[model samples]
Target: MPVLVKDYTWSETDTEVLITVPLKGVKPSKADIFSSEDYVKINYTPYLFEVFLYAPVVEEESSIRVGNGVVEMRLCKKEKVIWGQLESNIKMDKEEMRRKREDVVKAVQEKMEQEQMERATKKREAEKLAIKQQMQLEEEAHSKIEKEKQDERDKAMEELEEWKQHKQEETKTTSITNKPTIQPAQLKQQQNSKLSHNMWQDNKDIPDSQRPAPRSGGKITVNFTPRYFPTAARESTEKEEQEWLAKMAAARKIQAGTPSEINKNNPMLLKDKACGFFKAGDYEAAINAFSQAISLNPMLPVLYSNRAACYLKLNDNEKCIQDATRALELLYPVVPSNHIQRAKVFVRRGTAYANIGNHGLALQDYEAAEKLDPDNTQLQTDIVQIRNLISCDS
Candidate 1:
């Protein structure tokens, strides 16, 4: 009799093979599973599933469980060897089985191709949308800056008008208070002199090339020195001299020491300097700066994490692990431990561990990072690669 099969899924680990077959409305007690060193068979009244193993398995170690309308079998391999494919030969009509296999392979290939094309199309659409949004944001930012410039110009013009009005008011008050009883000719002469002085003062700011040329007849030169002194200096006495001496002493004190000193205890300043060194790719300088920042502010986990990154760049795996661990310890009290910063620290530590050939610790850290950033495809890939490495090593 020919063996029948049902809808199923199968997977393998380094030492075991697992198969899940849907039993659909069948009771667990109604299922029967049989196993040998090279084959597994399952029957549940209206359904059956069977597979011939490509390699030998421990029949005594094989086990089956039925739950939630499904039967799962776990077969332990006798030898720890990687299987290229799962199934062996089946006792079916040779030509019919060949045609069935070809049809299945073609269907699977077409489905995979369709899925790849769909993914490509979605990726292109996402990229186009992101570009469009970025362009819109840039245009809005430019428009905002232009509007701010226009507002500044308007404010300057308003201030100028206000100043002119204040000056005019001052001039009117002076004319009303000093209304002298003079003849029209004298008044006209005074007005002419004032107008000429105003014109000269205004033209003084203009460049010599842009100003109007003087008449060719003669040149005028005038020089005057005022006999005036500041009130503070003019009234200097014993008390003033004492105050001046005290001020000079204070100035000397500042010049002699304080001005040349730097406040190394400022954590924020140290952090800023560290970030600058990091951007410049000076890993050693960045590490020193971050170390100072951490000393000044030991509670800041980011400083430790940043120092760990610098150590990573310097290939100091031990220091990297130490700093990363310190950062995690500091971050433990934070409410949200799964932040991106924490995730980055985990990744850094995982990389350091992996570099030292400690795949077990690296896998643990990678798994933790994956929980923090589940959508990070690179982290997922790292996890898979680490698992494969562990399996190969085992």
Candidate 2:
């Protein structure tokens, strides 16, 4: 019997082998998967661009040859290009992507460091400035305190001289008008007053700039003189009274004093002078005047409160609080109806609290003030701003 032989060209599109049996020698009805006489070489489409074929098992030759069709391909293999130029372009693209990633990371790191350094520099500068400002304020306050002490001393000496001169004139007039007793104590007091007056005149000649500055280094020094306590009796004599009244009328022609129609010729004129000093930002002088006023009339809350305000401006928060507290203690229980007075102190305390960053305390004071004076637009605004700030911080 004879057998038929067929030849087939390898095709990339072929999937499986097609088998046929001959009707000739040793015909079997079944196909065998592994038999030397019953075998076929099958071709399959390559999965990717490259693959490796395994060598076929054979008995005759020492070395074997594998088929050329691809069986396996590397996972990294890409679509094959017509020319090598496309491969170079892909490699350049990969490098550029890597460079871009590195550049982005570097830029981010540099930006972060720059921001940190800038923040640190700002913090340092702010701290230094705060310290410098604090020191300057302290020096100013100290200077103001010292200057005020000197002014008080001079003013006292002036008052003593005036009293002595008045007393001496009285003694001389008495000696001429009636029998006089030259009391030794009176003589000594008179001599002392004259000496003090001369010393005061000398001190007055010293320019304020040449004089010692305030101990607290503040801009203003307060020197208060006690207004006449046992108010001096009016000098009698129709001629002299008319002359005095004429002089007072002339004085009123200039800038008039407040507390309207206050007697300009009264011995308490020093009180008004002190008020003027307070207005001039001379806390030392203001404080002195307030002290004298308080000494003469301890019932006045305005005097203490005014001094406290000056203390606050001088940055003497402790004294400010104390004086304000005293004013409130005196005024609150006695005059519960005084809203404006209490509001003023509350505003002062609130400012102190805000300056120290105690927003909670400041808020309390502001709220209290708002309750007392609902119509005060400025107070309403302050309360709103403070509440907003506290909310933000929290």
Candidate 3:
């Protein structure tokens, strides 16, 4: 059942109607607005609002705006007349209203998908046209240079024929000082023309710095911050866990840990099996076991944190970062109860980030963990190392 929203305001002009609905604690992205020429609806979780308009509106020209915790619709009236009421008195039963909303929603969704496809098609066509123009420009530049060379070749051939004729005529004369010969200055001018033509073509191809750069994208990395346990989260248990984790920071300690008490409903047995593989140095098997445990109990943050240790041992920093980050997210809200676990995950993820040359992000995680376990000298050292790495990069 939806809570019908009664708090809405509306005003009308001769040609348009402006309707505004204020939704407390609701963002525009979270609100789903559906509309047709005769109907409008707003669905934001428990809050729901819908209306069957008294008169028809031009749905194509109607516009919606959302800002500052309110959704406003400027509906273009089909007839230039003010309506007595916003909604029609004709009431709809639950099933009828459901059918109407469903039909309208389907139509709206189909239109959105069609528009997206059209936009994508247009984008691809534009890219093809742009590349084609670049190719034509380059080809024209090459053709011009070739034509310049051919004209120079014809001029040189004519000059050679004239020289041959002159030499033939001068064969019978001892004094040949007045013969028409190609001058050095003429040769230099021809050379300059060819050089300038070639240079122009060379300049037609833009330098790398002047041209637009290729589009690029960066990797998305998630980092979670642990809560600062000022009063010692979980007291003695938290202290002991933090100390143990600090000792095993390098992940070299392989322990034959005790198994959890067996219960038919308990999933710890699966986790214990993964830990056993981890202890025996069968990291791949441990990872598979951990994955199985995660599939069974994905809400357990410990499973991801444990699997992250195995990934780190295998020198797979990327996987380590992913698992560690997931573990921290599972331990969200950063309360005192989860402070210890969250800190451990933060340290593990920080180490993974450091391994992958993301010292700045690693430092961020380390600093968050430090607030939770201020007495841990190892955490302080890790933080210092990350800071040093960051400074070196700068």
Candidate 4:
């Protein structure tokens, strides 16, 4: 649609021209004004106004103002002379107005094309950047995969070398074992003959006091004899067995009453003792104490968990998992089921699985623990590490 030109009035002085348009409620900033030395154009929404000046004006010295629902412009004249009229004498007929409108439309179209070109350039650059980032990420992933494969190859080579060395040692052992054996009596005879020969050769150097005395007739006598012993009487065996059986029975009676007497029906004391042993790095003793405590109170989940920790310290991964699982099972359907204690059990089980090289199961348990306690940074780190291990294994 063609814009409606708004009515405007203008007055001129010796050095300036003042133009005013009544807007009623519109702000002057809403108008777009294009000014030059000979022509001026004012455009607002649904309104376009233009005029040819009577003479050239200083375009840079023009000013616009808006107040009281009125928009005004002050155009400073280049020459200090009064203008006969606000506009030029040349009339703007229909053809000239159409030409001016077409010129304005062309200028606006050129500006819009320039802006669109700039936007297209920015978009292409952004896409290129995104593609570059994706390629970088892919390269990093490929490098990581290659590194893991190399590590596996190196590990395999090490294991193969170890096996080869072990086989070589076994071969040496077998060869040694296949050699002929000497009888003890022959070996003793050889040693005695060697000793006699050496003694005869060194007889002249021997001291008289250290040497064996010789008979005056130069005759030697030798004797070989076997030792004999008296057999034992059979009467003492029955009495010894009877005394041993009595002592064992008494020990069993004491053992049966010791736990009840020392613990006095309190399992916490046993738990404390187990913890003390654990703190002292005596895992075997700690495990025994924990087992005893668990036997005393089967429902104590902490006992099982503590025992699982001890098992882990001992490198018994299967027992660790079993005890951790038992602890979790005992803790269920209670207030502590989803508490930090239960989460710790899951972490313990996960650690055991990790130690046994079961990355998938370890990841699962770590994730479960993470859900129970999301703020645990260590658990999160463990989960990521296990995931990486699983991926590498695959």
Task: Please report, in order, the local distance difference test score of every candidate based on alpha carbons.
Answer: 0.69, 0.51, 0.71, 0.69
TM-score of the candidate numbered 4? 0.34
Query: TM-score of every model?
Result: 0.34, 0.31, 0.44, 0.34
Write the residue-wise lDDT of candidate 2 on 192-247 in tens digits.
54554355346564422222211223244354432222233473244544443454
Cα lDDT of model 1 overall? 0.69
**Which residue pairs come into collision in candidate 1?**
none
| lDDT of residue 358 for candidate 2 | 87
Q: Model 4, range 298-323, lDDT digits (tens) per residue?
A: 76678899999999877799999999
Q: Which runs of model 1 end up more than 4 angstroms from their true locations?
A: 1-263
> Which portions of model 4 miss their true places by more than 4 Å?
1-260, 263-265, 334-338
Q: Residue 320 error for model 4, in Å?
A: 0.5
Q: Which 10 consecutive residues of model 1 have the lowest summed lDDT?
A: 207-216
Model 2 Cα shift for residue 374 (angstroms): 1.2
- How far off is residue 291 in model 3, in Å? 21
Measured by lDDT, the strongest candidate is 3
What tens-digit string does per-residue lDDT give for candidate 3 at 238-298? 5544544443332222222243533122334556666655654457877987787666557
Task: Pick the winner on TM-score between candidates 1 and 2.
Answer: 1
Error of 2 at 218 (Å): 74
- Per-residue error for 85 in candidate 2, Å, reads 82
Ranking by TM-score: 3, 1, 4, 2
Candidate 3 residue 37 Cα shift, in angstroms, is 2.4
Candidate 3 clash pair list = none
